[model samples]
Target: MMSPIASLTLSISDNATPYYLQLREQILAAIREKRVSPEDKLPSSRSLANMLGVSRSVVTQTYDQLVAEGVLVSKPKRGIFIANTSLITMPLESLPEAKSAEPEKTVGYFDSSADHSVFPHKAWAASMRRAWLNPDPKILMGNYRLGFPQLKEQLAKFLYSLRGLECGAEQIIITAGNRDALQLLQHMLKKHVNQWYTENPTYPPINASLTGQLEHLDVQLGGALPPENTSPWAAVITPCRQYPLGISYSSQCREKWLQTLSEKQGFVIEDDYDNEFIFHGRPVTTLFQAAKHRVSAEERVFYVGSFSKTLFRGLRLSYVVVPKAFVKPVLESQKQLGQSASLPMQPALSDFMASGAFYRHLNKMRRHYRMKRDYLESLLNAHLSQWFEWEKPTAGMHILLRLKTPYADDPEISGFLKSYAMTQGLQLSLLEDHYVDPMLATKGIVLGFSNTSENDMECWVNVISQCLGCYFDG
Candidate 1:
């Protein structure tokens, strides 16, 4: 019989992440969240292995690894119990050796994780150094399913100051990144939500994430927001700056979005992907504030913001401000998922934001990205104006050049150009590729201009133009 303490959820993926490591993360998360308390017994390795449908060896290895880390303790002829480590600062170098090999790093052609040239290495490192040296061991590892308290408090302030959104620290739940944020929401709300609505031409992976768990419904975007014939449980949208299209959602559009949520008492997952990148226009009214009169502030919107686009993707730090009602449920789901991001870095980042270093970094990057955006736009307009049509994006790291290709509906040319561009080491996303119905997908390639330096911009664009020239001028 499975013990009452054996309520561990282990979702095994047949990916590079080994099974033992996944088990370790789950147990650690449970401990940190206090879902499993100190002196509480854990299921025997044999029982856990059988429950999880894996080899008993896997569970034993995971338990042993945790024991070595001082996260768990064992008693002879008894069972494993959560360690009473009020604070744990086990040095990585002191841990038992693991069998996994370090993975190699690779850059994508469209990589926009961070501006490699301008990252505040010294500032970030200085903050982290202070956090690491703190005498409190809890800072090293505490179960913050909602996120480090310091980070949440600081982030709540940061969001209000920058985006004009208002919420308290309790409302903010930090996950590894947007992906984890969505997964946690899915885990918590799938029972209540039957369908998750998204924009038609959204990044494909956003829909891909909900596959199997819930149906993803794409509402075609155009001049006006469409009315929902049937109410959805919730909608995930990048309203401020719709992905790839670079168009901002109008007030009328926002009204419709709010209406759908109000009718169903559903929620909106607002992905503020390019929250700070707008080069023109006033900040779009946050979906949260827009819905305040119609519904309570917390019930209407789920504000999803990621440091990936704003700070650095590698940071894997993103925040979601849930409605007050959903806070406890989301945290419970996070505990079950055993999601633990780097604890030391969260507070360090919180300090970075509190000290205003984050804003400083953003100010610097905005100017840098603006200059890059201008250079890329100028190059494309000068050389390839006849072949493409596009608007200057008010904000974002990439611009979608809607191809005015002579062969309108033919995928052959667009497909060939995409394949050929790769040979020249140019990485880009086709706008058409993001659409659910291929016919509705627009023609053009999405260009991410953030990574290329000014000196390299002309060379890379010239090569890309020549690549397009072969197809167009042919």
Candidate 2:
């Protein structure tokens, strides 16, 4: 789960005069626009105060003003509620139109939808200062064309401890981010490999880059088609957590992957994005675990990971741990393409990991996101149980909801749901939206809870639940 405030939402600029008044105004606007209608008790005073980094009195004063204005009402036992007043009944004429006539910019690339204001700037600033004050500039300046030696070494050790793997510094090839790794990997292997296999309901960017020839698989359901016969030259999979579907590939299924790859001459690209954020029971084993059991004649297994899911997206750092055989070609491709991440920042990243700051920060974020995940999960159980079937992911940032519908085609339903999600500030992918085949497109919407706050979660989920009413009974 992501801190709603950390998603770069609700900016507070220097020109935001009368801070408390600004916060109050924002709240009123949401209420006026029916974004938060009557009976919608805003986040608790303490929570909102913390969210805005203001004194409790400030919130109290604003609440008092709304109460006096008859826009909000407080009950004896039940906390504050939006008053069912004329203001609530009146149409948009009473309220001013949205601030700009210009349509709001779409949240596309570089638009994380993260509440970045919640970032621990003070702490990060301290880390940056510490790095600058240190005597060793080589860590910052020296170019390890083979990628940052220190970061790779630290990551290798960390992976060994965390995921039970044996990796050397030489096996790790650090790059700008996951996209960079994908592009580089494709460039390196495209000639040798023509087809790329992916889960039917996978991430969009992954499908987009593969020239739209994604292999659609129906997750880990007991009775389904095994991908072994596909004979894909290469496959990219999220074994730990399937995006949107929130399904984890079963141990048997993982073994099946290894078995299939052994029989065929292909490799599996294991994308362990958000691998450390597991919530239920012990974290699952990595695809690398299966890799150790069976080494194909072609050495068909490559491991990839990124830091964007755990830390902020701006980090723009990801790495691939390639098999020894592919190392030469991958490095050659990187050199030809100038595909290296921030050379200097690698040491800072290394220092962050070596000093245990990475783990420390991860533990803190895990705790925070766990709370958010749990809260959202509880809300879903309470209100959406009838409409959706979902399994809580053992790890990862988002969840998949299987919606029941009378429609025979899944892609149509997926598109319908996707349109609704986008309207309410949600950027979600439909289960079948990434499929190359229309038969694979009819599924459910993938909800990303990482970037939304607990306060907004309830409101948005309510809207979605209502929209799902048409299909809920089916």
Candidate 3:
């Protein structure tokens, strides 16, 4: 009998995606096409790795994942075989359209604000090595759920001095990142708080965090709160520079929220996401301060920040500053959930921060990011002025451009442009993505400059300008 299935070859690409993922997809495609039948034995891992001219480890990992996923099975001595297809068959019509087997090569979009060009990898690694070499034995143990004490103390000093926060080491809880921080908040506070307010176009993860635990309410942030509704149990807000829009809350709006939270016995979670990179003289004083000073303020304000955006995304080090009253309960919640960060890394981060290396890194990044932001600003002014209007952001990595031409906000136009830009190797995102209700979103563009290196500006600007012009004509 013919055995094309056994002889099937794997194809790979040199795109942004990893080689292992490419291999996985190709094999799955062969299976889906029925070129490899149920119970059909493919080449052994070693054979396939040689045939494909790839690492045996990559092939092994892919096969293992498929085995665990039940797409393939292994016999004691026999080679790996495809699982019975009928048992887990997907209808041909049900399969979504496949992406290009080989994606085009170009600088793909980046969501991070970190400048890869100037990442302080050497400095950070040295710090980690030093701390890892001689960490306090207690830190290596998993007793503490809140952050390490030394790190928390360093964070307390850094936050209080820099971000206008007033949390003691006892009240600080280190988390994996913003998402983990919110998840911990949900599990900890769900018993007492069931109603949460978030910005209309809030970070998508916030919604996911609050789901099933709290009623997520929308707040139209640039102005005042939605008129005279019952106060929520708490409000999760990004105060320093709101996401997508890149606008700071006006003074009046900040005061209004403070007063509202005070009167209604509600809490405010101030997510100071982009505080350190402000192009302006200083960041806005946090609303947490007002909540701290006033009656019962401690319970009413939560300050959340992370080093991921500032230092590097892999750090996964974030923190929340709570009132003294909350320290025990939050820690108890952490204890029960067994959620904590890397054992050895926390001390390294503490050393980095305490040694002033972290702050110094931020200072350098601020200047670098500022330059990139300026480059973007000039490009937008020169090319996109007719079609968009924007407030140059004083902080944050992205700027939201309000669209001038019609039809762009229409689902078709936005969707088409995204596909078109991708085909042409331009990385861009739709402003509509941030809105809770995509239909209600305005026509805008969110351009991230932090990762847009100097060399990238010319090409990116030309691509965007040409795309916008074509969009206008058609």
Candidate 4:
């Protein structure tokens, strides 16, 4: 058999990259693909240079760099060889097929995400650069078990200004996102709480994240209050605006829920996600704010908020305002599990918030999304009224269009519509998919308007009309 080095199809292409780098990549690829194993002998710089018709200096540079990176071993007096390092092995058979050159057709996706076109890239870049140039010693040392202190301080200020929530930096824990916050709460509270409860038509990921027996509270029949039991329980609630349904909990509902939690010694995970996007009216009082004055309120409530919906989702930054008593345990659990939210972006986000860029971005998105929401409502009224009826949402990014006529096969119909919509370059979400129990799900479609453009909205609305005609007329 040919030597492993000789078998590698190394070539110096006429590209921007240097010849030495090109040869280095080809050799690395061979090792990664397992064509060359650890401890395999490599040809000397002179021999490789002669074989490839390149200068000895180029080969020597490549070898020296690889040896420094521990990819190659320079054994004194012996020939150079591949180092016995833990290089990843990607077998040739398992390699993915090369992507086609043709660009994919753009699809009008109605998912709950911020408009990517409006992201404040310049402002964010400035904040990132500032943070990098004047790095905080706490962030650089990675000493923040709870979170970057400056970010926690800024978040506390922002939350107090936005929602009248009284909290301190010590009570806040930076998480990857809402799901990460929920998972951390589950870990910390699993022993004390007997059962977990969520709204019936809740965010599906909430149900997926919690372990142990989970029960659903009905939102329609004024069953927002959990059942009173001797055993202490925990609940995950979206109080500012219910997901999919877009209904805010009334003052009476909030009071009743808090009373039940207090009497039963239960805990609540208040998910105040996307409340900043409220369009028409004044912002509603948060569950955390409502429970703050209650006896032992600090121990009974955990407030969760995230930037994924308000800002771009890729930020992957969320925070949980935990009870004062549980802060140390949660931080300890985070230490054991490893930090979920990355450290580099935390300081940058702190700068963004402190400099008032975050508030400005929120104000801009609120206006932009409100206009999109109204435009979509008008299109649905003009075109899809006969088959569907929807109440215009005052908060959150999406609207739920309930079917005019209840069908027993609603799930199947919605699933079929989702598949059909994808073929026509329009993405749709099934309202039924949001329910914990499929049997309790309402027949509807949830359309996200925040990310959809006016032109795409009109185009997709007509396509949706055509889709409905196929379903109803046939």
Residue 306 lDDT in candidate 3: 88
The C-alpha lDDT values of all candidates are: 0.72, 0.66, 0.73, 0.79
Residue-level lDDT of model 1, residues 89-178, one tens digit each, is 334444344566777443246444467678898998888777657624664335455778888999888888888888899999877667
Regions more than 4 Å wrong, model 1:
1-108, 213-232, 296-298, 405-407
lDDT of 3 by residue, 168-253 (tens): 79888988678778877877777776577777776777877675644444444464252244644767887667775676778877
Ranked candidates (TM-score, high to low): 4, 1, 3, 2
Instruction: Please provide, for model 2 over 1-474, each residue's C-alpha lDDT reduced to its tens digit, 9 standing for 90 to 100.
Output: 122222223322323255556666776666655566666665555545433434456667877877887877877766677777778767656743324245564532112233354556666666666665762544333336557677799999988887776778898998767777887788788766767677665677887756545555665452122465444477778877666455677777776777777786566787888777766677767777667677572367788888777667756678898878889998889777653465545666777778777787777776766777777789889887775678776666667666655443444555665577677665555556655564645566566666677777787777667656654344
Best by TM-score: 4
Top model number, lDDT: 4
Q: Regarding lDDT, does 1 or 4 come out ahead?
A: 4
Ten-residue region with minimum lDDT total, candidate 3: 218-227
lDDT of 4 by residue, 255-345 (tens): 8888876674788999988888887878888888777777766578899999888777767778999878899889878776656565667
Higher TM-score: candidate 3 or 4?
A: 4
Question: How far in Å is the alpha carbon of 445 misplaced in model 4?
Answer: 0.7
> All predictions: root-mean-square deviation over Cα?
8.8, 16.3, 10.3, 11.1
Over 4 Å off, model 3 = 1-107, 213-221, 224-232, 405-412
Model 4, residue 5: distance off in Å is 29
